[model samples]
Target: MNAFRTTRWSLIAAARDSPSRAQAALDQLCQAYRPPVLAFIRHSGYGNDAEDLTQAFFLRFIERGWYAEADPQRGSFRALMLTALRRFLSDQYERAGALKRGGRTVESGSLLEVIASDGQSPEDAFMRAWMGTVLEHAMQRLEEEWSSAGKLDQFRQLAPLLLERAEGDELRAIAVANGLRTNTLAVQTHRMRQRLRQLVRLELLQTVGSPEALERELAELRGALDEMT
Candidate 1:
């Protein structure tokens, strides 16, 4: 019922409606999440090849319609992405001499350098991966909640317009579309905003191991979104 949960559910519902759009949304989500994923891959000790492989895994997720298989009832999006990443790494390890090699010449810098820029240890890298997994799960929960409530369709139609227009214009449009009075629409919008915040907090609760961890994780989530902007 928090903002994060609402956003997460909205996205899941959107994804369920259209795979292409879902992928686009997922790509946007990944931009916030990729650094941690990359750090995990690097800490696991794969070379730059592994980094490229990690990027390719995301690309494949879209190209193959991977999100279509995501089931919020079964598990979280965070678990799914990390599971896929682990599988990809496992398959790559099976390739000839993949694990035996030292640093082979890569186009970009070493994966380790990318992951350990601030003297980060392998444990730090692992924590990053854990965080990414947690956030992804939170997103999935939000999506499921919205889809169940059947407001996802309305949200999708109005989100872009509302984001662009002034409050009066947005209220007018929403009121007309939903067959509500302007005052009623305004109240609905306020409720919707409240729901979004609640959803976000719910998601944050699931991701962080404890209440003390929530503040830091929330800050990181905000920072990740800011980076996208």
Candidate 2:
């Protein structure tokens, strides 16, 4: 298993065994999930202060050791994170309302009126963002791997086909353009897809506690991505 996958509950253990290593793991997770966190906050009507709020939320999360309460048996890390973020936003809203009641001026733009035009809850929006980010990171790692092997151009040309359907004629055209046989191109694309799946699983594994949880998360990821299409 990758050192990065030794996170979540393992991270809490690390805090006891090695605080520095645990902190590094926490930082990596925060960076990876920042986009989804921001999406949730913005969708919750904190668009104006999303950046500051995200930063502060992360600071509080880490400084207060809130993640120490994460129990793998209860749920995946993603669930734990979303729950914490929702609570944080609720507290922020309550604080602003209290200030207003106390005759303190709360910035008008601090909390915009939530307009969920798509009828998507903030939780749903956050999951979509998380799914997208996972794929983005997986693709990035795929590119780096192929690039290091001197096949960056091949990876680039075939990457789109990995995620989208292409007719036989189109596949042949792509193969011919690259001076390769259609069958060979098909094999290469299959390999690429397999590699991508492995990378995506690795990415998801960091947030899961066990193999069962990993499978569950991967299924959820696939379902979420399918919904997007």
Candidate 3:
């Protein structure tokens, strides 16, 4: 939220001294970007071979102190991560022959069976995966919140209307199904939509380094969604 508030993400700042804290921050960063990174590797032509490389890249990324180079003044975390991932892949292909996943050592393969060459670049694959991850996080937060309140059934009934433009008749039908008045259901749908936006904003904030960058990040997300469709 605030600069002082976000100082805790100083996981990198404490990294040279505190290994545990640095690992925590690295884990947070990886959790946010892992989906898109892996998808980009896959679309780059590695197919399932991308999985092991993805894991190896992350291990090298944190273990090698790459987070120390994060320059918020330069760009979004997306750009930084992609740049690092590209470098990691290049290095892997250049020096290393195989990557270790768990106990098994898997060898990297060539781009033979292309998965996303249908008019989409690696950036497109990253955007698709990132957007899907964002939506999934929002839906999960919404469900957990509703479930914790013991109103999961209410969330279920209101989810469809919240996501789509439903007619009055359809709203009424959903209201009847949930034993709720049409007016009540409509109001709940509005609130649910508001909550969804809040969840999305919170999730987006985890990637953006500051509150000021949030709107721009959201615009990027919107652009990504538009391109994806």
Candidate 4:
């Protein structure tokens, strides 16, 4: 059921419904992928123009109603989005200089900021931005879950264990501060990791069109993580 709950279909349905109801899902999809798309544009050598192009690209993609007719069966949403982005860039490149990019700009130091300036490959920059945004999505959800449960501080204490390597001394100190034994802290961190894993999968599920596709994406995600290390 989660497979079809993908934003690909949601945006499609929203488009078919009415313009007013369509923006929410469309906005969500655009916002989730914006960082990577912007990174791609940045690495393509647009520099200061990437931010403007990012907004313009999204506005074109949605306002043009391209996604409403997009066939998710033809390809993954990731592939489709990238393809759309490339097309947007190609069409806009010649006009970029003439387009006047003085509109809204990206804030200070986003994931895509200075990606191209850092001597990173376009593919690497895009992947870094993609993974970063996905992790941000999952972290935000976990934070919300903990906040809703009134365990935000506990989650904060354990979050580092899941997302980053916490030193043994630090973990033990956290345990002592939280009134938990070392073993109890270990168990809680394990549970929190499990929850984080589930949330990550949930985020991935939204990007896939089917259960089989989701499984394939999950396998690719693991491979990507492995390669990152």
Candidate 2 stretches with Cα past 4 Å from truth are 1-5, 8-26, 222-229
Clash statistics: count for each candidate: 19, 0, 0, 0
In order of appearance, the predictions have TM-scores of 0.43, 0.85, 0.79, 0.82
lDDT for model 3, on a 0 to 1 scale?
A: 0.74
TM-score for candidate 3, residues paired by index: 0.79
Off by over 4 Å in 3: 1-17, 21-32, 96-118, 167-170
Residues 1-229 of candidate 2: C-alpha lDDT, one tens digit per residue? 3554355556655654576675675676678789999888888887678899987877777766777767675678788788889889888989998998999998866876664577666777899999888889899999999999998988888999999978999999999988999999998899989999899888787777777888888787778767765
Q: On TM-score, who's better, 2 or 4?
A: 2
Which digits, one per residue and each the tens of the lDDT, describe model 3 over residues 169-197?
Answer: 88899889889898888888888899999
Error of 1 at 85 (Å): 0.9
lDDT, candidate 4, 1-229, per-residue tens? 4447546566766765687866676677677788998888888767666788788887887777767656655556766677788778777654543443645444343223445557776666677788788788899999999999999988887887897767889989999989999889988888888888888777776666676777887777678667766
Question: For residue 81, what is the lDDT in candidate 3?
Answer: 74
Question: Which structure among the candidates has the greatest TM-score?
Answer: 2
Q: Against the unseen true structure, what C-alpha lDDT does each candidate score?
A: 0.59, 0.80, 0.74, 0.74
Instruction: Please give the RMSD of candidate 2 to the true structure.
Output: 2.8
Top candidate on lDDT is: 2
What is the overall TM-score of model 1 with all chains considered together?
A: 0.43
- Give the distance in Å from residue 140's predicted Cα in candidate 3 to where it truly belongs: 2.0
